[model samples]
Target: MNSTTDDTYAIAIVGGVYRERCMRPAWQEVYGSAGRAASAMASMGVSVELYTYYDSITEPVLISRAAIEGFKFSGESIPKSIIFDYDHGLATPRIYSFGSRQSSLRVQAEQVLRFGMLEGSATVHGKRVVYDPQSPAKPEPFRQNGSTADELALILNYREARLLSGGVSTSADLIAKSLVLDGHAQVVVIKCGPLGALVHDGKSTDLVPAYRSRSVWKIGSGDNFAAHFALRWMEEGKSAAESADLASRATAYYCQSKGFAIPEIFESFTPEAIVPSEAFRNGRRPVVYLAGPFFTLAQLWIVEQARKDLTDMGLEVFSPYHDVGCGSAEDVVMLDLAGIERADIIFAIGDGMDSGTIYEIGYARAKVKPVIVYCENESQENKKMMQGSSCLMCDDYVSAIYHAVWTACSL
Candidate 1:
């Protein structure tokens, strides 16, 4: 058994730490997953510290569980973050409008950095640091601020990377170069969901393939990847490739179990046992636009299942949910329209009167594209406008998919 004092390696996590509220299907409160990465690292038996700013609503339970110690700055009020997750769907939308509250967090991070320098303790001064810019808007504040650590890891998703790179390139190598050359950080990791991650270590880059899971809860998968990778590389004396492989497996476990805690089975897990999901399979196939409302868990599940089934039938699927999340209304509209324009056919789940799906149906019709509508419980009210010569309506999802496959073949 490893105690905090016995652990030679230590980690410092700096990012948004707040309370999260779910506003879809039901209203419930949960801890922020991204903010809880320190705890995850601590559970792995590495001494961990956290530098964050929080308010009264922030829970103290995770702090003790995940970190050996923490430094917190008090804000005027607690930031309220909301997530719209539906049954562990891949595209869980989030609204993290933290306003000006995040601006002060960088100051707290700087203080922690200075304190580490003054203390000069092995755990405090030599700790590997993880800076998780929770949003695209939050990166600028930390970009130029000088913070030093034994090794610094910046964890970001594709969108956040694009924002930081000024839309130049989303490549992990390019982002890392920008960060290193610009004096922002020494190492960069760009996590592309489902496709895995790109780890750039100043000189070289490695592509880590994601391990497949039967069910996916993508809420905190990237956080798990970043934290575990840092632990393995810094604490366990593993190479970049080895650390990333383990981190990928750890993320797979987190997603599969839908738990914030790291699983014991991941310690012995290897990539050889992984079987990539059909979505990750490479081949040329007709692109089908999966147009529907993912506002509910049931709807998101249906869309996800349809995507997998359609992909299994050798048809490429472009799902709006997979691409867009908590963006501007214009961005959402433009992205969906572009996808519809690229797709050969549209598969819409018309269980209810989803305005967005209805608009997609009309758009596809105007574009002279074939539209397949699937409604589980048939009703005359919902079928009036859908009854047309160009549309195929099916009560069963499988029937709709078969019709879509046949339609694609004919085209």
Candidate 2:
């Protein structure tokens, strides 16, 4: 809008800057909401600014990235969240929040800002509000932290939309329209993970299909999507629907390359073939048969956690531990086999190389069902035949689960 580029930034991200410690598959570093979004936008040569809260005492490696890819950062003094990211895909990263969200900032009209009502005390002078409800399950969370409805673009996942809109309908169009018509938002963007995204601007809704990446990296994906969308729609003045579609492609690239390589242009960039994976197509979710042992406490925990994880990801699961308990040998065998037959995919625990679990995997394979084995520390000799039979054996637990679901959804 103006030639005063030094005084005006194209995008402004207000979120967090904190430590992220991931376990099972271990990785420890400082990664935050605004920190990531700013980095991503800056990587693409966007003039961006980040506003966040972090421990000013220790002064963690906040943004010492490549010189050209660095953005302007304003950090509030706070011992912020130390998020524990575990291997259990179903579980949310446990945030050990130390400080209160008491901060303020000036929202310039020239800047495209996305604030989740983090600091309700701040004076927002922008034309539109960018709302991210943070988490749906926070203790009485969505209390309108600090957002206006007029000309608001609401970015939310399925759960947040459900919490705000009410009811249990999974249709993105219905949920988005309800928000728009009800005046919760002028524009509603429902991020449906693998099923793409729904962009609704009161008049109509469009489903921007998600491009399947070779390796699906879950961490910071939402932040990447939101930043790219802000750049395209808010900064560059693209339509909501077109911006959303472009954002989806950008997100796929982020996942595929883990934000290492930045494309020159968003519109012309095709990291890989844009193959859409419909996890839920025509109101049908592929059934997943969870085959694993429950003899020991450790074994039982894995099986239980995996079951919940798969279910939370919106797949109907037939877990032997939950679906069928202690029973006669003949009955258990028959029931488990029946479950396997009905399932579109089989996720088996191959760590212990349990006879029954192995049998289930073999049976599922014989019956032409897709099988994913989570064998973290099993020998190659032991899994040779299963591998030979074309079973997808994954050493990482999370990868195994995702592989199974993706395989099943594609099928």
Candidate 3:
């Protein structure tokens, strides 16, 4: 029986890589791509899972109701039938093929070794230095160790056995056919970057155009595209043509916005607005809310510096993590503390800022609080979130505080 009886359906992605030589970049690309797809799928209400047979530990963290099960690359637990999470309407039981099934830890280890390629060797400004090859450098015309035996064999065997034999015709063509013939999937899309995507079913093939963008990091874009398309397909439940079209539109919208790269989606957190009279008894000073994800080491330094900057500027600052005791609530909450509620201005750090911080921004703004939003990049999504409602956009925390303090004083 078809499992999608409810309003939503679960999708399992059983794709991953475990290359030995090109481990780091390979797995990084794979996980990064997959993570984007997973996030996109989540956005569209599809229960999604990625079962990668690699040892890399860079997979996306699943902290909410949705679960991403990571087994050892070759673990037996992964071979079971795909199933969706019934309670959450998440894709539970879908398995997408990646490579030879392997254990997760071993795959992770192999990924690390690939990452070690960064230390192999390189030339900088005429000085021959073994530059870290593992770092996501500009795509080179040729890959290192391209002539290795295993890679050669894998390629040769795949071409000879899979391509030459009666495996459809082209790899992508075969993949399109397999979506229907083997997986019983109704839609299949293969993205070709600038060339766009080629979508197909058993009967027909459609070529979709790629959206043009000014270039904000090109990492994980394909994953984002896939997830968007899959979820859209599930939601629309229309023809394959319509689903692919919606997928194309969604990818274009995401590419033009920041939700694909940075994780904060402010629309989801738009707090209930408060009347001017209900303002806190203690008058408003400016308070900045930091919410999104946890802080990275470098981001931590920036946050610390921002705190110092705000303190020097004589603005009252409240970081939920640093100042208030907050739990993992879905929406932001405003503490009944003295200075928080009456703040004249609100500041929020959007990138990976915890949920509490984000809530504070919404809470303050809902009360018509003047808000300043600072992010590392000038992402369109962040810009839109902070738009019109007394929010200022900033590149780094330093300028963010500066803008917030200035705006508050001017107000």
Residue lDDT tens for model 2, 228-320:
777777777788998888778888777656663365555466754333344356547889999988999999888888888887776899988
**Top TM-score hit:** 2
Residue by residue across 124-242, what tens digits does model 3's lDDT show?
11010011111222322112422111110010112222322245655655655653465323344554333345566557887665443322222334445545544444333454555
Instruction: For candidate 1, give the lDDT.
Output: 0.60
Candidate 2: list runs displaced more than 4 Å.
Answer: 1-8, 57-60, 66-68, 79-89, 115-123, 138-151, 166-170, 264-279
lDDT of each model, Cα atoms only? 0.60, 0.70, 0.40
Cα error, residue 184 of model 2, in Å, equals 3.1
- Superpose all Cα atoms of candidate 1 onto the true structure and report the RMSD in Å to 1 decimal: 11.0
Model 3, residue 204: what's the lDDT? Answer: 87
Residues 90-116 of candidate 1: C-alpha lDDT, one tens digit per residue? 223455454342333222221122111
- Error at 212, model 2, angstroms: 2.0
Q: Specify the highest-lDDT model's number.
A: 2
What's the ranking of the predictions by TM-score, best on top? 2, 1, 3
